[model samples]
Target: MKRIILVAGATGNLGNKICKELIKRDADVKAIVRATTSLEKKETLTKMGVEVIEINLSNIDEVEAACLGVDCVISALAGLGDVVLDLQKSVLDGALKAGVPRFIPSDFCTNYNALVPGENRNFDLRRQFKTYLDGTAIKASSIFNGAFADILKYNTPILNLKDKSIGYWGEKADWKLDFTTMEDTAAFTADVALDQNAPRDLQIASFQISPNMIWTDVNTATGQEFRMQQLSNLEDFAQFIKKQRADHPAGENELYAKWQQAQYMYSMFSTQHARLDNLRYKDLDWTTSLEYIKSFVK
Candidate 1:
C-alpha cells in the first residue's frame, strides 16, 4: 500500500527536497502550505505532482482536516521561536486527531541532546518541543544531521568557503565535525518516515572530519590551499559565551542568538557527543563534502 505523507514547510529548502524524495519513492505526497506561499512555488510543486493544500497552520481545524488521510507528517519548519512552537504543536495535535502513525519534526541540526539547557536558544526550543512530544501518543522521530553541506557556501562563522577558512573554538586539529548534504538529509528523512520500524532518534553524518581535513578537501576540490582560524580556545570560548550573554541579556536578539548558537555548536562538534547512524541506512548513497564542493569548484 502506498503511504500518504503530509509535509509541512514543503516550500522550504529541505522540505522541498523531502517532497521530491517522497514522490520518487511512489508515496502519496501532500504538502501543507501556508496561504502566504507564492503561487509560483505552488505551481512548481503541482508540476511535480504534489497535492498542495493551502491552510493557515494557526487554525487547528484546517490543519486537522489537511492531516486526515496522512500516514505520516514531516515538518521542515524553520526558526527557533514561539511561532515555531505553536505551529508544530498545531501539526502534532492535528496529526494526533487524524491518527497519523508517524511524525518527523523539523530538527535537522546537531544532536541537541548533548547541549546544556540555556546554552542555545534554538536548540532549547527544539528540545522543549521534543519533551512535549514524548508525553503524547504520537510516534516522533528526530533527525540530527550535523551541519549541512551547503553551509560551506554561505558566510557562516563555522566554515567560510569564500574566505577559504575554517573556524574552531578548541583544538581544531583533533575535533571532528560531522556534515551531510541537504539533499541526502532529505532523502534519509523520507526513507525513515516511510519505514514502520525506524527508531525514535537517528543521526547521520556523510563526513566527519577535523578542520585540517576540511582544509584538505577544500584544497583538493578547488585546487587551492585554505587557511584555518581559531575563533576561540577553551578559555576564550567560555569568555565568548559570557560576553554573548552580556550583549544579549534576554537572548531575544536573533543575530546575537545565532552567534552564540554557533559557538555552542562548535563546542558540541569538538566534543563529539552524538553517535552516527549512517551505517544502518545502507541503501542511501550519501554525498561527501568534497564531492559537493567539487561540483562548483573551478
Candidate 2:
C-alpha cells in the first residue's frame, strides 16, 4: 500500500521539492497550507496531484484533522521565531493524535545538536523542538544536510562570484564545510520518510570542501582569479555575535538577529563538529562542488 504523507510548509523551497519527490515515488501526498497562500502556489501543487488543504497551523484541531490517515509528516518550515515552534508543535500534536507513525521536523541545516544553546538562535529553536519531541510518543527523524550548496550562488559573505572573492571567518582555510543541494536533500528526505526502517536521525552532505577548494572551483568555473578574504578571526566572530545580540536584543530587530545567527552558524561550520551520514544513502548521486559551481558561475 502507498503511504499517505502530509507535508507542512509545502510552498517553501525545500518543502516544495520534497513534495515533488514524493509525487515521483507515487506516494499519497497531501499539503497543509494557509488560506492566504497564493493561488499560483496552490495550483502548482494541485497540478502535481497533491491534495491541498487550507488551514491555519496555529489551530491544533485543524492541524490534527489534516494529519488524519497520514503515514508520515514532513515539516519544512523556514522561519525564525516562536511562531515556528508553535506551528510545528501543532503539527506534532496532530500527527500523534492521528496516529501517524513518523515525523520529520524542519531541521534541514547543519548538526544543530552538536552546538550549545545560544550559539545560534535558529539552531537553538530546533534544539528546543527536538527536546520536546523526546517526550512524545511520535517517532521523529531529523535530517542535517550541512549548508545548502546553492547558497554559494547568492551574494553571501562566504561566496561572492560577482566580486570574484570567497570569504572565511577564521584564519584557517583548511577547515572543511559540508554542503548539499536542496534538491538532493529533498529527494533523500522523501526516501527516508517512506522507509520504515530508517533511523531517527540522519546526516547527509553533497560535498565537503575547504574555503581554498571552493575558491579554486569558482576560479576554474568562471575563469577568474577570486581573491580570498579573511572576514574575521574566531575571537572577533564571537565578539561580533555578542555585539549583534546586545544591539538587537530579543524581539527587537529581526534583521540583526538573523545576521548574528548567520555569523554564529558560519563559525560552527568552520569547526566541522557534525558527523555526516552520507554513506548510509548509497543510491544517491551527490553533486560535487565543482559541478555545482560550474552550473551557475558561468
Candidate 3:
C-alpha cells in the first residue's frame, strides 16, 4: 500500500519541494493550505497529484479531520513566531487528536539546539516548540539539515565570489560548515516521513567544507585563486552584531534581519553537524561542495 502523507505549507519553497519528492516516491500526498492561498499554488499542487484542501489552520477540528488517516504529518511551514509557534501547535494538536503516530516538524535548519538561547532569534522559536513537543504522546522527528547549500551562491561573508576572498571571523578558517541542498534535504525528509521508526533528531549534510577547502573549488571554478582573510576575532564580531541589533531596533519584527544573518554566520563557524544522518537513506545522492560551487559559476 502507498504511504498516505499529509503536508502543511504545500505552496512554500521547501514544502512544495517536499511534496514533489513524496509524489516522486509514489506516496499518496495530501496538503493543507490556507483559504487565502493563491489559486495558482492550489492548481500547481493539484497538477502534481496532491489532494489539496483549504483549512483555516486555526480550526483544530478541521485540521484534525484532515489528519484523520494520514500515516505522517510533515510541516514545512516557514515563518516567524506566529506561524512557527501558534500555527505549528495547532497542527501538532490535530495530529495527536487524530492519533497520527509520526510527525516531522519544520525544524529544517542548523542544529539550533547546539547554540545558546540568544545566539539566533529564529532558532529560539524552534527550541520553544520542542519543549512542548517532547511532552506529547506522539512521536516526532526533527531534521537538522544545517545551512542550505543554496546559500553558497549568495556570496556570503565566507564565500565572497565577487572579491575572490574567503573571510573568517576567527580561527574558523578550517571549520567544516554543514550544507545540504534543498533537493537532498527534501529527498531525505520524504524518506524519513515514510520510515515509521525515525529517531527524534536526524542530522544530514550534502557536504561539510570549510572556507580553506572551499577556496580551492572557487579558484578552479572561476579560474581565480581566492585569498583567505580573517575579518576579526569571533568575540569581536559577536559584539559588532550585538551593536548592529541594538542600532536597528525595527529588525526585531523582520524575519531575516542583518544581525540575524550575522548570527547565522557566527553559528556556522561555531557549531557543526557532530554527525550526519545522510547515510540513513542509502539511495540519496549527496551533492558535493565542489559540484555546488561549480554550479554557482556555471
Candidate 4:
C-alpha cells in the first residue's frame, strides 16, 4: 500500500520544502492549501506529482475531508491569531475523522515546556496547542529548532549583521545557538513520517552555531569583516526596541518591522537551553554545517 502524507500550510517556505522532500522520497503527498494562498506553490507541487487540495484549514469538515486516507499529517501553519487554534482543531478533527495515524503539529521552535507563562505569547499558545494534541488518540509531536538559519538575511535592529553589528544576550563572546535549516528539518521530518514506530516527539537539530561564530565564518567565507555586539538581556533589548519604535513609529527603514518578528527570536535565544538528546535520530546521520548554509547567507 502506498503511504499517503498530507502537509497543511503546504505553500509556506518550510512547508513547501517538506512536501518537495517527501515527494523526492517517493511518498504519496497531499498538500492542503487555502484558496487565498498563491497557486505558484501549487503548480510546483503539481509538477512534482503531489495532490494539491484547496481547503480552508479553519473549516473542520473540509479539513477532515482533505485528510481522508492520509497516513501522516504535517502542519506548518504560521501566525499567532486564533487561526492557530482553528487550524489545530481542524487537523485534529479531520485526522480523527479520517483515521490518520500520525500528526506533526505546527511547532518548529522552542522546547514545549520551556516557556515562562508571560514571556512569549506565540510560544505560549503553541505550548497550549501541543497540549491539546496530547489529549487526542492521533500520535502527535513538535520540533524545537532554536531558530531558522535563513532568517539571518533580514537585518533586525537587535541582531542586524548587515550594519557590521550583531546584538545578543549575555557577554560579547560566542554562545551556541542551535539552528536547523529548512531543508534539513524537512528531510528529518520525512524520516519521521517514514518511521512507523518512532516516538511522538522527535527532534532534529542541524547545527548549534553562535552569532560570533556565524559572523567569523561569514567573514572568512566572504572576506567581509563584521563585528558582533552583545546586549545585556532580552528586557534591555526590548527596551531599546521600544524606544526606537516610539521615536520612529513610521520609519521607512525595514528594521522597525523586523523588530516585531525579533520578539520570537529573542524568546528562542533566551529559553533554548535544553539539551536536545535526539539520539533516536543519530542513526540517520543528518547534519547541516556552515558549508551547507553558505548559499543561504546574503
Candidate 5:
C-alpha cells in the first residue's frame, strides 16, 4: 500500500521541503495548508501534482475530516497565536478521530527539558501539548534541532551580520547546542516518517554546535571580527523593551507583547545551553556540516 502522509503547514519553508522529500521517496502526500498562505506556494505544490487542502488548525472537526484514511501526520505549525497549543490539540484530536497511527509534532527545535521553567513561552505551551499527546492512543514524537538555521530570515543578530555583530546567549565556552539545517531536517523527517521501524523521539540532525565555536566559524567564514554581546542580566531585556515601546508607539504594541513573552521564556539561555546528541539517525544518511550551513547565509 502506498502510504498516505499528511503534512500540516506544508506551505512553510520546512514543511514544503518535507513534502518534496517524501514525494521523492514515492510517498503520497496531502499538504494541509492555510487558506491565507501565499498563492505562489500553493501553485508550486499544485503543479507538482500533490494534493493541497485548506485547513484551519483551530477547527478540530475540519482537521479530522482532512485526516481521513491518512496513515501519518507531520506538523510544522508555527505562529505567535494561542493556536500554538490549540493546533497540537486539534491535530491529536483529529488524528485519533481519523484513526491515524502516528504523529510527528511541531517540535523541530532543541530539547524541551533544556529550557528552564518559565523560560521560552513556546516551550511551556509545547509541554502542555506533549502532556496531552501522552494521554492519547496515537504514537507521537518531537524532533529537536537546537535552532533552525533559517532563523536569519528574521534578521536575528545571533546568526547574521545585519548589525555588524553576532550575539549568542548561554553559559561557559564548551556549551554546544544541536543544529540541523532546514533542508536536512526536512529530509530526515521524510525518511523517518516512512521507515517502518523508525521510533518516536527520533533525534535527526547534522551535529551539535556551541555558540563559542559558531563564533569562530563566523569569523573564519565572514573574515570580519565579530563582537559577542551576551545578555547576562534578565532585567536588561525588560529595559530594552520599555525603551523600544517608548520610541515606536504606533506598531510597537504587538511586537512589544511578543518580546516580553519571549523575554520571559528565553532568559534561561543566558545561563545554560541544552545539548542534544542526534547521532542515532546517522544510519538514515541525513547529516549536514558547518561548512554546508555557510552556503545558506546569503
Candidate 6:
C-alpha cells in the first residue's frame, strides 16, 4: 500500500519543500490549505500532484474529512499561540477523529528539551503543544534540527559574513550546535512520515560545527579568513535579552522579535543534540557546513 501523508501549511517555505520531497519519494501526498490561499499557490501544489484540500480548519467534520485514510499528518504550521496552540489542537482533534496514527509537529529547531523554561517564547509554545500531544494516544515525533543552517547567510553574531568574522558566547567556542538545511530536513521528514514505527523523538544535523569550527569551515569554503570575537557569557547575554524582552511589550505579538532572535542565539550556544539519528534513513546525502558556505560565498 502506498503511504498517504497529509500536510498542513503547505505553502510556506519549509512546508513547501517537504511536500516536494514527499512527492519525489512517491507518497500519496495531501496538502491542507486555507480556503483563502491564492489560486496560484493551489495551482502550484496541484502541479506537483498533491491533493490540495481547502477547508475551514475549525470545522471538525471538514478537517476529519480531509484527514480520512491518511496514514500520517505532518504539521509545518508556523505562528504564535493562535496557530501553534489553538489551531494545532483543532488539527490534532480532527486527526484523532479520523484515527490517524502518526503526527509530526513543527518543531524544527534546537533541542528545546535541553533549554530552561521561560527562556525562549517560540520554543515554549512548542513545549506547551507537546504537553497536550503527550496526553493523546497518537504517535508523535519532534525533529530537532537546531537553528536552520540558512541563518548563516544572515549576518548574526555567530557568523558575520560581511564582517569576515566568527564569534561565540562564554566558553562555547567549541560547542557543536546542530544545523540542518531545509532541503535536508524535508527529505528526512518525508522518510519519517512514511515510517510507521518512528520513535517519540528523532534528531539530526546535516553537519554539527562549533563557532571555532565555523571559522575554519568559512576559511576553507571562502578563503576569506574570517576573524573571531567573543560576544559575552551565556548568563549575561541571557539577562540582557530578558531585559530587552520586558522593555518591549509590543514585540511579544510579533513572531521573531529582536529579543526572540537573541533568545534563539542564546539557545544555539546553550544546548546541542545529545545524540544524532542521521543514519536512520540511509538514502539522505547530507550537506556539510563547508558546502553550504561555499554555495553563497562565491
How accurate locally is residue 215 in candidate 2, as Cα lDDT from 0 to 100? 83
Using alpha carbons, what is the TM-score of model 3? 0.98
Off by over 4 Å in 5: 34-39, 55-59, 152-164, 168-171, 228-289, 296-298
What 10-residue stretch in candidate 2 is worst by lDDT?
Answer: 251-260
Give the TM-score ranking, best first: 6, 3, 2, 1, 4, 5
| lDDT assessment of candidate 5 | 0.68
TM-scores, all candidates, are 0.91, 0.93, 0.98, 0.84, 0.79, 0.98
lDDT of 3 by residue, 1-298 (tens): 9999999988988999999999999999999999999999999999999999999998999999999998999999888989899999999999899989999999999989889999888899999999989989989999999999888878888877788789887888888999999989999999999999899999999999988889888877777888899999999999998999999999998999999999899988889988989888788899998898888774
User: lDDT tens string, model 5, 25-64?
Assistant: 7889998778887899899887776799888867888889
Candidate 5 versus the native: TM-score?
0.79
- Clashing pairs for model 2 are none
Cα lDDT computed for each candidate against the true fold: 0.81, 0.82, 0.91, 0.72, 0.68, 0.91
List clashing residue pairs in candidate 6: none
lDDT of 6 by residue, 1-298 (tens): 8899999989998999999999998999999888899999999999999999999887778889999999999999999999999988889889999999999998888878888999999999999999999999999989988889899889988888778888899988898888999999999999999988899999999999999888888788767788888888888999999999999999999999999999999998888888999999998999998889788775
Structural RMSD, model 2: 2.0
Global local distance difference test of model 2: 0.82
The regions of model 3 sitting more than 4 angstroms off are none
Tens-digit lDDT track of model 2 for 115-200:
66777777777888888988899888889888888777786767776777878876767778878999989989999889888888
Worst 10 residues of 5 by lDDT: 264-273
True-vs-predicted CA distance for residue 47, candidate 4, Å: 1.4
The C-alpha local distance difference test score for the whole of candidate 6 amounts to: 0.91
Cα deviation of 269, candidate 3, in Å = 0.8
